[model samples]
Target chain A: MTQISLAKCKVDQLVKLCEEFGNQEGELINVLHKAQELVGYLPREVQEVIARQLNIPVSKVYGVVTFYSFFTMTPKGEHPISVCMGTACYVRGAEKVLDEFKRVLKINVGETTPDGKFSLTSLRCVGACGLAPVVLIGEKVYGRVTPGEVEKILKEFN
Target chain B: MENNITLKIDNREISVPKGTTILEAARELGIDIPTLCYMNLKDLCIKNAPASCRICVVEVEGRKNLAPSCATRCENNMVVRTNTMRVLNARRVVLELMLSDHPSDCLVCAKSGNCELQDTAIKLGIREIPFAGEKSEFKVDLSPSIRRDASKCIYCRRCEMMCNDVQTVGALGAVNRGFSSVVMPAFDEALIDSECTFCGQCVAVCPVGALTELSHTNRLINDLANPSKTVIVQTAPAVRAALGEEFGLPAGTSVTGKMVAALRQLGFAKVFDTDFAADLTIMEEGTELLGRLNAFLNGDKEVKLPIITSCCPGWVNFFEKQFPDLLDRPSSARSPQQMFGAIAKTYWAEKMGIKREDLIVVSVMPCLAKKFESERDEFKTNGDPDVNYSISTRELAALIKETNINFMQLPDEDFDAPLGESTGAAVIFGASGGVMEAALRTAYEIQTGKTLENVDFEGVRGIENLKEATIDVDGFELKVAVAHSLGTARKLMNELRAGTCKYHAIEVMACPGGCIGGGGQPFHHGDSARIKARAKALYTEDAEKSFRKSHENPYIVSLYEEFLGKPMSERAHHLLHTCYFNRGKEIIEQ
Candidate 1:
């Protein structure tokens, strides 16, 4: 089932965006990037619309979306939290920092808070290996984050 | 002068044309190299050499690592060892890793004996799996015609290539990432919910037990055991051509008489032929084509040209899902399987003084889609299906084996009278361009007031993807086309969609070589030669028939006179014709 009723205006905007890309199948990933930006996140309805506009199978659209971890089918929270799991961060105890965030947020990785205020995700190499075990909330970054500093980091977002 | 590449394989020198893979070069030298995730149906222009499965790894003299023989091109003077210790160890390790992630249920697996993975395991002399880990598990998707067991999938991607690239159905794709990756429908939906045409090409190409036909042999056995019900069976023309392969008989060997005898021994009350209904199909479809052509000639702008054949259920589902707008362009005549079911359940049932519910009609087809076709709601009345069950040629062969009947030793026996009788045109329905040729043989004679001495329409009789020809029907130039496989069909459909198609009639078969290369036929393992052989067998049978045209079948003529007034009559339309649905709308609405 469609996870959300994508607004009619948003649907029109998606179609317009696809038309701008010439609706070529080769531009699928590019179209999907713009679609995700417009729709906040790629839901079933959004993917279906993009597939119809591009004249390809919805399964193919879903395949491309699922292949990359950067693309998400579910909506991200307003204050998104990303835990860097690069080699430097993992060696510096990023798993403990991630576990602390999961405990305090009461949500697993790639999940949003019940109030939809914060979403937790683990990404690879944000190019800040010097600040190992880094945790970023929205635009603010906390370098060399420890397990105890997770709640304080959440308080700043609040 | 052709540029050739010289290669040394197992100390044997051989020269092959440029761009030939090491696998092909080795094969040329009669060196059998094991491979998986590599398929080449050259005749259909379909090849899936992803090199995902490293089972075909070989030792190259200069390379640091073992190269996949299936993907590596033969280099001039390049030394290759197919059976070195290093190569054997790497191959075994690769297979062990695959087995660690795959379920060990081969004993009860549908493709137990026929699985390529299992064969490779034995060929490599693998006794124990040295590696064990968590096996990926996914819910089995059981569609009407095929079964999908994702747990058994080894990520070969052969099914993906067949579904998307070859058939252009787009029902399956490689989804997710890493260990959880699988070839499945979008959103992990069941195949029935997706745009799957039930072509079963995915099942045909799968090297493991991940994909297989949803068999009806068990239910058929139950029906045969039920004494209260009189079970009658009809075998499709293509089944006779390829069924012998299941019993170790060579490809292209027609075992029609032996097959009939086996079915009789299997305790069926009557063993009929689907070719009878194929003849009936030509009578209705040929007449419909003539009517539309004549109407178009008389300045009727509404008449749709290029009337596509509706015999292949896989092709029917393809148009319904992909080309819904051109629904009116296809002929309305039901497939031969459905036509036979309708006749058997109505005319024959009543004549035998048997109630419809008491009479069971089973079809032995060389197709997987016919199983899905038989289950369609349109082919049913008051919850009772016209055909009680549909089984494949492989299933019949299995039944003959399960019953301990020596298929090779069986005596030659003819089909039962009346319903069993058919014409040459009907038998040719097994091949790709056959329906178009059969219809032309009858339509040419019926349109002009001249006898068709030359029944063979050579232009439409081949394995070409898209074939076109023009015939002189009196003074009129009648244009026609034939296409096999959905990818080829899509090209023609796109032409019609663009309003550029000029043919008056077109025929499309979903499989590569029509029913002879059907997904439910004996597994060719991506060999185009086997498919060619099966097609040759069908043509041989067609040549041997006494009556070459559908109209020449006396039983069909008598049936029209006694039961159904004539072709396209009200009664005939109700039973012999059907309508199309916009499955695209259904999917979108859902």
Candidate 2:
């Protein structure tokens, strides 16, 4: 049996989240979506809690988290930046735009800055191929973004 | 039969049953289809044809492109071209892509000669990889029994299927996406950190160098070479039936004599058989079973029903982690390997007048878990392991070859005396239901004090995951269930938990076909027939024995009369009996 975590409050929340889904293994994705929303990220500890609650192995939960593009293990910064690497965006110089964001932010893709104010990540298709080379910062989207505009985009977050 | 589908492969017509895949149909037609990630242990309910590798793509006539024969169901009047130029080109291109990211260290790979990937490459005649790109790099994860190198994995998912589906351990699964995707435990932790039972089924089915045993050959060799040490080796019952396969002997061929000769040639002072201890185990375990049966008959509520066998180290580890609450339900008798080691360290050493420190006892087992079992703290005495260490049947073969011992030509020799003498009952312990059958031969006679007319309990035999039989022994219908894989064992355990199991006893073997199909045995390449063959070999050896009962073994009778005093005696408990640990809480510590 899975012992309750020492951090009782958050673990209670995780247990509650799993109970909400009736602890069905088929609801792993839905539970994961809500759990990620609640916890901000799916760390190994959180995954173990969910695994115990759902009566599944931690490896299965981790496999699912690692398989999907949206699910992430690390916490996102307040000003999380995502550059689309979709085929359409790539055709429209998204690589250059992504590199410019990395350069200005001084953080690699999937990494956060030392100050933790900004995190960089790459996305497949934001479903905004019409707005090629799109970059998003916290809900705000920048379309037709040029490498030259990367500095201005960071200024808005600042 | 009426719904049989007709398909033509290479213009040869063939009719197959419905739901038969194109790959099976093609193979039936004497066409060998090159495949990756398409393993099918038909009778065992283990399959990995995820169609991810796509190496078995065939040109299905009228289709726009090629179709994966492994996943595609053969249709009526379907025309398939397996060796078409287009199919060949597609297959080679897929191979090149896999090889591009794969490490080119075939020479040093543990699976170099026997790797399915290498064989497939050679079969396809792939010369050079045209497409080179970044490879997935993962830190090597080494457990006591298995080593995992994600970089060498070709995404075949065979190990994943074996670990998750076949064994139901769920210690491994595919993680990440696209090229970064690789199979591993959560957080890619070392295998020991996960709930891995060290069953090594993953290692057994791994087609490449991604999964291999953690070889301890060098340590064993050094111990053998030490002049000051008196080295003795005990071979497991299952080893003789399968060790010949590594030297090109057909599967299931009994090489006991030759194996003994080879061991002797390799400088071991004495070569013993674990079967002797297996016979001793039967004497002890059989008595324990009868005690429980009598207690239940007397309305003792505390006596747990359906006492499970504890001879398999893998099964022992599984229950310790997954079913800790039922730890007392299993027999406390140590496995034959450990029992042999304990007796060798205590009784044999005492008789020989050799200090225990100078005596080195090694086990040659057909299991990887036995390697882990020997080093366990519970199996140790005053910081010294009862069994100093153990090597797999594969490792023993390697040692024999390295020592220049001709295994095939060597004359068959009998096992040494005192600790090596065993009966037919012990010999059959190599098979899945063999232990139960062996125990019946003794338990029945001991309880009734009558001669057992026929020792063969054929009802307990077969390779099915779970089997049940009832024996009417003097009005006591002893219901026994034999379960050989953890997946199947889980079902029986669930029955016990639900209060639905009425069995008086159950035998559990973690590997598919008991020890004969153990993870450390010569690789069967997912062919279960070889496992059946090995089991048959053990049966043949059993039939050849004069004494067919454990209680009748002269050596066991003497051991009890002299040292043990009787079954379940204090001295017997000190050496032959062991306890189970609750590993259920261990996995969560991390």
Provide the TM-score for each candidate, comma-separated.
0.96, 0.95
Candidate 1 stretches greater than 4 Å from native: A1-6, A86-88, A103-107, A113-115, A124-132, A139-158, B1-3, B585-590
lDDT by residue (B319-414, candidate 1, tens digit) is 998888989999999999999999999999889999998999999988899999999999999989998879988888899999999999999999
How do the residues A62-152 of candidate 2 rate in per-residue lDDT, one tens digit apiece? 9999888788887889898989999999999999999998888888887888888998999889999999989889999989999999998
Please give the CA lDDT of all the candidate structures: 0.91, 0.89
Tens digits of per-residue lDDT for model 2, B1-590: 66589989999999999999999999998899988788777666678889999899999989998999999999999999999899999999999899998999999998998898899999999988998778788899887788889899998888888878778888899898898989998888888878899998988889999998889899988988899999999999999999999999888899999999998888889999999999999999999999999999999999888888999999998998888888989999999999998999988899999999999998898899988898899889889999988889988888888888878899989889988899999999989999999999999999998999988999999888888999989998899999998999988888888889989999999999899988888888878789989999999999999999999999998898778899999999999999998877422332
Candidate 2 wrong stretches, greater than 4 Å: A1-6, A83-94, A100-106, A123-158, B585-590
DockQ of every model listed? Answer: 0.42, 0.42
Best by lDDT: 1
**iRMSD, model 2, in Å:** 4.7
Q: TM-score of chain A for candidate 2?
A: 0.80
True C-alpha contacts between chains kept, each model in order: 0.43, 0.49
